[model samples]
Target: MTSALRVLLLCHSFNSLTQRLYVELRALGHTLSVELDIAERVTEDAIELFQPQLVIAPFLKRRIPESVWSRLPCLVVHPGPPGDRGPSALDWAVLDERADWGVTVLQANAEFDAGPIWDHDLVAMRPASKGSLYRREVAEAAVQAVLRAVARLAEGGAIAPVAAAATAQTWRPSMPQSARCISWQRDDTARVLAKLRSADGQPGVADNLFGHACHLSDGHAASAALLVTLPPGAPGELLARRDGALLRRTVDGAVWIGQARAASACGEGKPFKLPAALAFAAEAQRLPELPASLERPDDEWGELRYRESGPPGARLGCLSFDFHNGAMSTGQCEQLLAALREVKRRDTQVLMLLGGDDFFSNGIHLNCIEAAAYRTGDSAADESWRNINAMDDVALELIMTTDRLTVAVLRGNAGAGGAFLALAADEVWAHRGVVLNAHYKNMGNLYGSEYWTYLLPRRLGSDDARALMQRRLPLGATEAKRIGLIDRCVDAETGAKAADFESGAIANGLALALSHNLAQRIAAKHQARAADEACRPLAAYRQDELSRMHRNFYGFDPSYHVARYHFVHKLPQAWTPRHLAVHRERGTAA
Candidate 1:
């Protein structure tokens, strides 16, 4: 057993990786507090007040001040192999096509990522983008490395230092746009993909499309039909368009560019990343539009797709909505609602909602709503209202379904209204490593309404439900299970490495389990729905919630707009929020 220790979590942002570490450490009975990397004085003040026994910087953009590190041990999590030292470690790893990579937990020294290593773990690299790999493989390795380091610290022992040698570590600078630029005229499909993949989530590859210079992202190798329809265009020329992307012919093949961000004469602005079609509307409309086929192809890329499997009566229909970064626009919500209704019309015993690999959903798309303020000459408030209502429509569809038992299988982190959306299902299951931000207060005290006023109370009484909505913190899958937030947490056993929940193992396990007692589960679902309707109608719950939401969307207050603008623009933090910077709270510091 490990003794409880006060651990101060110092990070740049409470991102996915930091949230995972926060949840895991709290589960181990560690008293944890958070302090963003704001400034040296603020960090020093936190250290003096919290007086934590140990400090862990899960993610940091700047170096820890000497005043604090000299006082306490500060462990920095670096996404690189043991001997790799740099800021752009993952970027280089993906661009270089390394077969294996790892994460290192090292003590913060005068030099960055050069401190004595407490522990490190190697993870086989996946052919994924920097953001995807960071969320999955790098994150898993970091957890293992951090846990090993913490356990060693708990038990008083001499930790082995990483051996130093000449040319042991390599330092790589931040990748510039020039380095990420793709050459459609010269580069093959694989080379172009590597460049674009390295810069997927942020700082997309700078390139030209339709006589305009813009950054490209969300790339996919063309499907069979798309490949055949490439109208013999010259290299580097835009061939066709579909949905929100434009297809460009490469030296060997073609790639669909799903998103882009065009620079304007007004200098750098908030609309840095938008759907390719939306950003270049006129140009996109000129190209031939090829609608995605309803028939699922062997190899194709799309935001939504459906697949049916299982033998005879045990037939299962799985609908996956893999939205980029799990953000759903107003149109996306309507499209997915239609897709959900279509899948329900099919002949299947059970229906499973398989969300994206990295995120189940983070609620309505903030970026799209923010973009509407400028792109479509609409008020941000108007767009937000439409988006939230569309989200409610999708949730309502899930709530009213009675034919087949609906199961929400969360394989990734979910937040805000997304958590409540999952609750719309008959049964909600999640992978072990998943973290759920169940509260909406973090986004400027926005009172969320996705039929949550009803769905949440049904699971955890009235007062507990109210308290949960107010507690603005990330909940791990295990803790969420105990609090009755989810029906089941599959493979949530504690161990070293983070759970490989991204793999289809949990979904397969669920399919097998449901197959055994299909009739009873379906019957139980029906009876529960009937009983719930008798108690109180779902429409009443939606009305009550939407009434409060109306005040939020079209009220005198503009807190949501201010907060949403700051978030969508990637504004720098003025001061860390009191909830996260717990060390400053008079009596809250551990």
Candidate 2:
């Protein structure tokens, strides 16, 4: 009980929750191993090989086998309040617009999620998608609950079983199409948004677009300004299009649908969740396209937006890109590049690249690339090439800029090429809770080309940079700062208060812009960039990196493609990655 628990994580996939728990457990000095919950046999094999003191199911689709839980101490993280049971916990919460929710870590039992209570954390709900809530609030609460549960076990405390519900209301059944189905003619904006929010990531709400059967997702209400352009149309009629989303008329107002999955292509356990505009390409073109300005109404939805703040002489620019799941496709990359240029042209003394609060970026869109593979004359390989190159362009703008300081302000998690992209900034300010997977080897040994060769080595130096690249693990914010991967955290980097973190950091950032030595700092940055460029041009580093990436895209090795395909389609991994399954290593306990 005193020593670190030999913990084994059994998850459906290395999702956000699992990844957060892995990072947390590793940081807590626990010897950890991870195994995908592929099948009952595989889970048994992991248990046999790991001989773990505790098993944690952070995320899973199916229930754990009775054989294992009966013999071993195991905990399952359920995304629901105590007594609220089912696979569709979050879905039901969003559908019913529950005021609050909870995450429970309970001992595994014969019945699904009906285990003895260990610990739980509760919080009020936020207006966001199911995926966003899962990553941020629920995931954070689960961490606290799991940690508390482990401590409780360490204390040899007797945990009590879940109490019986007073009514049948606590029972959450698997939502059928009838439940999430949208009746555009009858459902108001609030009702429509709730349906879309509940089914954001998985089996989306059933609806037909362009007279074709499809499921709708990524919903946002149409901005008031956009209402002026609306024509007299039926409730279910498609009114206009913008930023790859379709504006559909509703009973009271319109809602913007960002993505969809065609029913016919739902076979073979494949997914084709494409941009709503792309999903109905032929029909979309027939509708009028709406143009949105970079600076618009606050409630409006757009992936890339720009805002300038602070006093006149020393102004700050915040360029926020809230891309869905932080997956940047070729077009998104280009859009970001153009936006960066526009923002740079302004007279702001500092620029903050504020990516979404849920995820900064996970690199190129694998789903987009996977969708590309099915189209005529298009290959996932080619999409990879274009997307990476476009990403490089955005990174280049960050690296080459010398007029003002650039800061990558991360409010959420960042991975793969996205981690490197943040490095292109003069400094990076991350939230205390941020987790960064700064390596690319996991994604089929991706060499990765976001000028990482030039950026990482310069920041961390050659030896440590190479070590980090090969480590194949996530770096917590504190550890990342210790390793010089980031500049500041909740603490001040530019002499700002860290009490409110992001807000305090932003206030301090403006102070940094107005600092007396700001000009000197900018001059030094410019000189340093010029010196680096002279020694090894960014183009040279980029060309070298892209040369290797070209092979990853077009070469004989199909590892990247295969890995990406499974990842995009949400395929269950057959085996745990060797890097994560430390128990399987020789000389370790078996």
Candidate 3:
């Protein structure tokens, strides 16, 4: 028989799940305290009042303070597995078309969901509604897992933490309103549906029809036909109704919507009713489409331009490394490497610039992996091994080289290789809102760029680094700065401050020359020796761990199983043989 345990339920909104939890706990004769609208400091008060042995934070949007979490034992019920920790976990998993998914019950540490795992329940989900999957499947799984976890704690048995499988995968936060907008011109029906599903249960997808706000939903999506009027004076000015299917247009000579909502309102709440017409508003104005004749030679490096204002000679050559539109390609890496070498030889300073307002890079493109996997389908292990090797080569070169002073100036979010790129830099300057993380581990491949094991420990202490690597920590700028991972936090700006290095003034020029002279002297006497000796081994050890991590997490490609555990079963899967092996190795090695 189990003794009644005191459990406090923390949530933002009291949903059906919360009500069920309350009832279940009562039936078990365990005392329960409910706290809703629990944000920041309020959480501390709730904790004090409850003084419960176990805390179950479910659907709580606000981050709990470290002080509150440290006071007592607590567990967080995450919708995804340990590796799949993040907001919008379910939405991301569904859009990715993962075969399996699960929930995790983790120790409540200062870090978000990056705590050690107690247990998890796995679930398999079909291609279904996101709301149905979460409310019906995931919620039930979460309840069962919580009960099991509580039972384990009551028994006074040691809780085992499952290390997340390794891969250089990342989690993207919910896309902003602008990024989530539907681009009718560029998107196909399938793409549009994906976007609609992604933004479902949130603000629906917005479309701009000459400056009108037209929101579309799958609610009325089953209609077979639509009629749309082209902009005034444009080609195909006549309005006509046609089948509302994705098809190739005879006049346009491209894939186009067969039917669309007409400009004129047919009726209130009707399918053909014209949403308020408005001009197209994008986060960024679209660049003019390039002409086919303007293609650069394949062998030539693309010229990249950026601004660096300060005293004369004070501005360093900025690399502005970006992998937008897709993952970093081999050719792109090769071109970037050459650019870095050229900048080094020129004795210019370098700052890697990440393009796009949101992402620095998405890491190795999945398309590339899929293509390689298909080509070498007969030898899956060899294909994956080769892929990991190639990725490591590029990542290691970036981390080890770069003769000039390298600074990763992060103005936006960075993940996977983006995070690795920042870690490789001598110093990282992040904006207030930036997010940095080792997202690759969430994917099935653990052999992320070799720098994580070494740099992570150096930036955050060994204990924290271990937690981050295994638990997959996502640090905001302030948290990152507090842990010494980010050197300084600055606001986005146009002009320079006194403390900032300037580009053209006489005083700044002299300062740059003096700084350069000092840097050269340091390199000759200390920096070079330190790099080859201390840094190299540290980096190598990290790489070694990463290789092991890949074998442990993705060696057998358990992602499908892991995903099934979350989505369909809505229950946590037990540690696999591979996971146990890795855990034992770490234990014995330690």
Write down the lDDT of every candidate, Cα atoms only: 0.80, 0.84, 0.50
Lowest summed lDDT across 10 adjacent residues in model 3 is found at 275-284
**lDDT per residue (tens digit) for residues 91-148 in model 2:** 9999989889998887788877777777788856777789878877787788888987
- What C-alpha lDDT, on a 0 to 100 scale, does residue 472 get in candidate 1? 88
Best by lDDT: 2
Q: Write the per-residue lDDT of candidate 1 for residues 1-590, one digit (tens) a residue.
A: 45777899998888999999999999988888899888899899888889898899999998999998888888899998877888888888888889998888888889978888877888787666788788877887888788878887666644444444224878888888878788778988888888888888788898877777878887888777667756677778887776677888888888888778786411345456777877787778888877775446956777787887766766678788877788888988998898998888887877788787678898988877777776546766788889999999999999888767787888788899888999998888886788999888888678898989888998999999999887788999889999898988876422222344434543563475457677787778788888988988888887887787778778998888888888876777877788877778764455
lDDT of prediction 1 = 0.80
lDDT of 3 by residue, 1-590 (tens): 46777777776654445644555565567776666543555556556555677777766665666786777766777788756656778777766656778888777776667777767888676554455456445766777787787777666755444444323335667656565555555654445555555555444456533344444433212112221223223221222211111222222222222122322222232223111110111211231211111123322112233334344444454544434322454444555555555555554444444333234554554322332322323333443445445545555655555354556666455666657757766667665445566646655534465466666777788898777667443555666787787787664321112113222222332344448474674355346536655746645665685667556435576672244224222222233222212222233221
- Candidate 1 residues lying further than 4 Å off, grouped into runs, are 158-167, 264-269, 375-377, 492-517, 587-589
Off by over 4 Å in 2: 155-169, 263-271, 491-501, 587-590
lDDT, candidate 2, equals 0.84
Off by over 4 Å in 3: 1-313, 325-335, 371-387, 444-447, 491-531, 534-539, 549-554, 560-590
TM-score winner: 2
